[model samples]
Target: MTGHGSGDLRERPRVLVIAEAANPEWVSVPLVGWSLATALRDVADVHIVTQVRNREAFLRAGEVEGESFTAIDSEALARPMWKLGEALRMGQGKGWTMMQAVAALSYPHFERLVWKTFGADLEAGRFDVVHRVTPLSPTAPSPLAAKCAGVGVPFVMGPLNGGVPWPKGFDAERRREKEWLSYLRGAYKALPGRRATLRHASAIITGSRHTASEVPDAFAEKCVYIPENGIDPARFSLVADPQGDVLRACFVGRMVPYKGPDMLLEAALPLLKAGRMRIEMIGDGPMLPGLKAFAEAEGVAGQIGFHGWLAHERVQEVMAGCHLLSFPSVREFGGGVVLEAMALGVVPMIVDYAGPGELVDARLGIKVAIGTRAEIVEGFGAALRRAAESPQALCRMSAAGRDEIAARFTWARKAEQVREVYDWVLGRSEKPAPFG
Candidate 1:
């Protein structure tokens, strides 16, 4: 496809977005996809290819304004035999082995199916650029990147999660990450075509400077730090509640091991014990039962409320009522929830690690020091006490937090940065320009 230009400036280009999952109900990925689509609409013809878990829910969610949506049926590639083998292996307590085997056996076939089903239109050179949002493993590059390359289109690889080596510290965790890396290396060797596909991509976009720095010195030159996530400041703005009672704290998003819901429960125990605060958990996941049990055991059961999973609109409403947002997650590229809380004028008490460390300004919110369970508990307790003792301080931090997000983080700004990367990849720009 030929590039479009208006006068001396390039016209809005057509961009194809590929993601394994983009169901709106799925949380993070969907939000990222939707935001990107919305932001790029003015400058590009955006077409998205993503798997829909629930067709009805997806349809109900409707198309993001100004972008074309294409739904890929995952059922078409759900190999029963592979699933059975994986299930059996998982039953035997070999989860990683099972996952690896299934991915190795099924990914290529799945990729082929996706191509046969959707590649013709894509390969016809209808899109000027291709962007992959969820690059979890080499499988992400296997057929998608290869197809884009085959068509002579510039491919942007990014928002990729796994494969990068974990940071130092946490001996047991590091050992497991090394093992996973070993397996990934073997998998890549076995799938040379997939490896080459990703290596040939025009550029790789990452969510943070931390991720961009860790992009393997081999691809470091190709790596670009363009945050693909942010909060909708307007949606999370502060609200006036004349009858609001008790200090409400909220935990939003998935309840998983790395998310540190357990940490929040532990930290809230002392506050709850003292009847100083009420906790509201607005999401559900595998860790819900454990979190609930811990809260009950700590004698704060009555004070805690679990709203399960709520719609996006409702979540914003719940957030508006919150006095603070407590996120204890240990692993995150950057927590969009933290930004959401900040935008909503809720002080965030986040762990001093990864995402929070990078985004949280001490002047805006508390960054609890990373340490043992007792230390974390103590640190969070101290932050809570500080907020409680000084309402004026909390108000100041809340205003600053909102101001910071408005000034630095926004989907419009993030999308424009991504578009610049696309522009550079397509040879429209000679050098990477600052994404204002």
Candidate 2:
């Protein structure tokens, strides 16, 4: 009881943070893991536990290995599992569900090692709480949850954001991405440790409403909604200022089917042809060549700038010059790009579903209704025209988006919100409602 509840009376709680995928040098989930874990240091007495692979990055970032953090070497099982996942996934950027399925098999080894390494300290109350901040997929169950609960040490899991069902009209896109396993994704709920993981966790942080909805009604009271993605204001220091009759819109994602790069192109075709809007496409993928051909064939190539992948700074520079982040991805679990764009005072125009839908509103940004491909194109097209017609209103939304991100969506703010959850699970305060 040293650090638990009303025992120690320390200003900051002591937390052992588990983030298997944390790496400062990486992107997506790894970057998210690194950011959130490090940010939590500001609000807690923190010790990070990550995989052996991220040890070098942690050292480079000034984290003293074995002091500030500990690296669990589960490579004996993890490396082969990852290679098998790669082999079965069919291609890069496809078969995401297959990869996660493989990961679920290997992650238990990591957690087992964690308990072996830290179990005694946990039972002795060396740390106030144990938080798992990575493997954000809802399908991945944590064995540590039950272990911590058994020890009277609170366990917090997630901002878990994945498992958003594929929309009604995008089966073709799903198939193209080799997501065959997605059809059976629901079966994870019946997996052995899932119920115990939810049942034993002191707090469950749902990263999106869809993920929140996935938590059964029986455990609803302990669930808290806080998106896994957050903006680093330093990286997005530039501000966008679009000053012209033509709408300056940008799309920042993979040029793939579900991302709807083609849909965005088709939607903005009339605007591009009429010289009323210019689009900057800022990523590369299998669809790039086809998109190029379509733009050239439509005679709108001049209005669309196709910049294949750029460095993060360069991407921000491109987004900073634009007025809107027009992303139409239909199946994002965490719309990190939308947050990045909003941080730069760039209003987002995204399809209203999953992560992006939960992030935006009429006050900060625009949301197109989720629908079939044709309907999405029409929706995006009309949204583009309306934005063009009301440039001043768009500018106001841009500023509002930046303000909203600063207040509620930065990593620092996210860490504080998480601290509130820590307080609740530790019995120092009541359960937290971070957003409300």
Candidate 3:
């Protein structure tokens, strides 16, 4: 088990999946990383390469370290650097500027470890491809792109996402979030290996229009847009059955300024006060106290359920009981919860701007156009009122959203799409038509 199988040269292409963050015990980027890596197995023979931190969890999940996945013991270099960055970050995302620096330091070691262990096999054509599937952050450069190209093995990067700019007129929110280095976010285009990675990559998959546009014009041909989020249909086994007579709406996300949880409350106040609708506010963050107080002050607290930060499964259960997921995050990157809601047949109402905006069209759910904070709040309220009053219309949207998810947004579907890309890269097929 100390070595890997070089996959039969005539069989399915062997792929090395690199995801430093991939671990089943974790959530967020790690969950996406792990899921995507595992999903690739249905289409290609794959060996995942990840960090030492994920080893125990990987083993617990039934993976044999050297064979199924390569656990790169890079913590000696990664942990200290992470600690230093966290200290400097000081609980402020600051547009993720500090973390990008930390990533610049740590991510390379992951690539180095991969090459150190498998460079010989790669050189001998043991694997047909190398795909770096994590650090989903586009800012993190993969030194392996150049290395892979040098040996004639195609390298693919991304589903890289991030850098969605804040909606206009939210400077206060920007400062509140300690986005000090936001102004220089554009400087990432100048990172030492960024351009080369794009230039040499066999393909670059982007998760958002913002991320797609980040690729330079010259490398645009290689850029492909595929959302970085998907749902496990089993997690949303709750049929679209309502719990009560009132058409309930739910908002699930961190109670942060950018997330617009306050806007959900402000928008739903009229319906919540009238007993025509109920609200379930899930998840917790710095904005929780204020959101609770705001509901009480507006006299709609009785109609709203404040269940802060439920487990993922519980969140789905709560979502199943509701008719819609109302999210107004101005800077959302994935609107992942929205997809989960859709998978459960709960329609979503999201601000039409960044990630959520791109995902929702007239068919999926509601898109509240981006505008001044006041305008967005008013638009969300109107959307809530409309959905609350019309059961038939809301049901139609719910069915359509779930159908859309089942048809195009599941991991199974994404892997098939990725398979298409592989065919294109290997000359087994022509460039794929754009994702519909």
Candidate 4:
């Protein structure tokens, strides 16, 4: 289960990246997969194998499909089931959870296709490592780990992250978000290939303490904690405009129940009415109508600007124009937007629970203690008031946040950290330097 170091080893390893969602034209996990895969090219000779849906986008991005990347067609295998899931989701009205279930069902086929196409090269030692970068959930099992083990090729899983529970409170928000599937999330461990994937993985990289805790005691030795979310320095540049007397706060995600945008709106109402602050809502969701209505009801609608869905770059621009990012989503997995805000010198005010709670520290920004929904709203309002009254303290935190991200959270830095894990797996080191 351990490897011996090569006396005079090559520093750069050849890696096969299995990313089901690595597409440039798309955002979210697809963008994450694409960014992570490309970043690793600086530390390793990388070849990516992803689903066929991403093929055209990769080609458009200047990667020749069969060479720089290989497209594995999964449409035929997934289409029927995906359609059924979609139809059921529409009928039942809880698409996100249903989509996760559908994705879990389809992921094994993508991994199987990856192995079938590249299993020979892996068995023949053409690649130094096999890293599965997508379906980053610890719940979704990959079939190729055991095959890699048998062939003596090391396999890496994750920066894998998921299963951050709905915190002790917030039952109302959870129920409103239609998280029926959250109740069944734990059953994934009992799935057919779950144990073997964990058992045979040469290294298991977890993103959060919650997911890291889920790794069984037997495979715990190989588990390393490295957050999966990272910032793209090129896209999210540091731009600190001089602060005006009017403090501007922005909430930049979907306006969903779990995301807590309405809670934020309520929290900032006092500031909005007193002309002490401005609130910008920069993304659209099903809750848009309700959010708008609530703002109007509170008589602060004029103080809040609803910029319905923006392009990725535009969203950053909106964020940069603001002073603080108010994101209290209690169930976020990566909270990449938090890092993006920090990259631009905008301090974040986040709830202390899941991903945002894990990333933001006292020095970087404020973490409101989690409590009942009303408590959270009141806490956020108090935090906003503190910022309005203390510009110097806010300035200090903003500078520190920008500095923190440049040093630790950039994509290149994250890639280097992953390379350390690769080296450790190849027997070049005892373990990756602590993922701070």
The candidate that wins on lDDT is: 2
The deviation in Å at residue 87 for candidate 4 is 2.7
Candidate number with the higher TM-score (1 or 3)? 3
lDDT of each: 0.65, 0.90, 0.83, 0.84
Which of the two candidates, 3 or 4, achieves a greater lDDT against the reference? 4
Q: Which stretches of candidate 3 lie over 4 Å from their true place?
A: 1-11, 92-95
Q: What TM-score does candidate 4 get on C-alpha atoms?
A: 0.95
* Candidate 1 least-lDDT 10 residues: 1-10
Error of 2 at 32 (Å): 0.6
Clashes of 4: 0
lDDT (10s digit) by residue, model 3, range 232-324: 776666767786667788889778898888888888777888888898899888889998888888888898899998887798888888888
lDDT for each residue of candidate 1 in 276-355, tens digit (9 for 90 to 100) = 77878988877788888888777889988898999877887877777788887665665788888887788888888776
Output the lDDT of residue 314, model 4.
83
Residues 129-178, candidate 2: write the lDDT tens digits. Answer: 99999989988889999899899999999989899899998999999999
Give me the displacement of residue 56 in model 3, in angstroms: 1.2
* TM-scores for all predictions: 0.78, 0.96, 0.95, 0.95
Candidate 2 deviates by what RMSD? 2.7
Give the least accurate 10-residue stretch of model 3, judged by summed lDDT. 1-10
Which residue runs of candidate 1 sit more than 4 Å off their true CA positions? 1-10, 52-67, 72-74, 79-125, 136-139, 163-194, 232-247, 254-257, 285-299, 430-436
Clashing pairs in 1: none
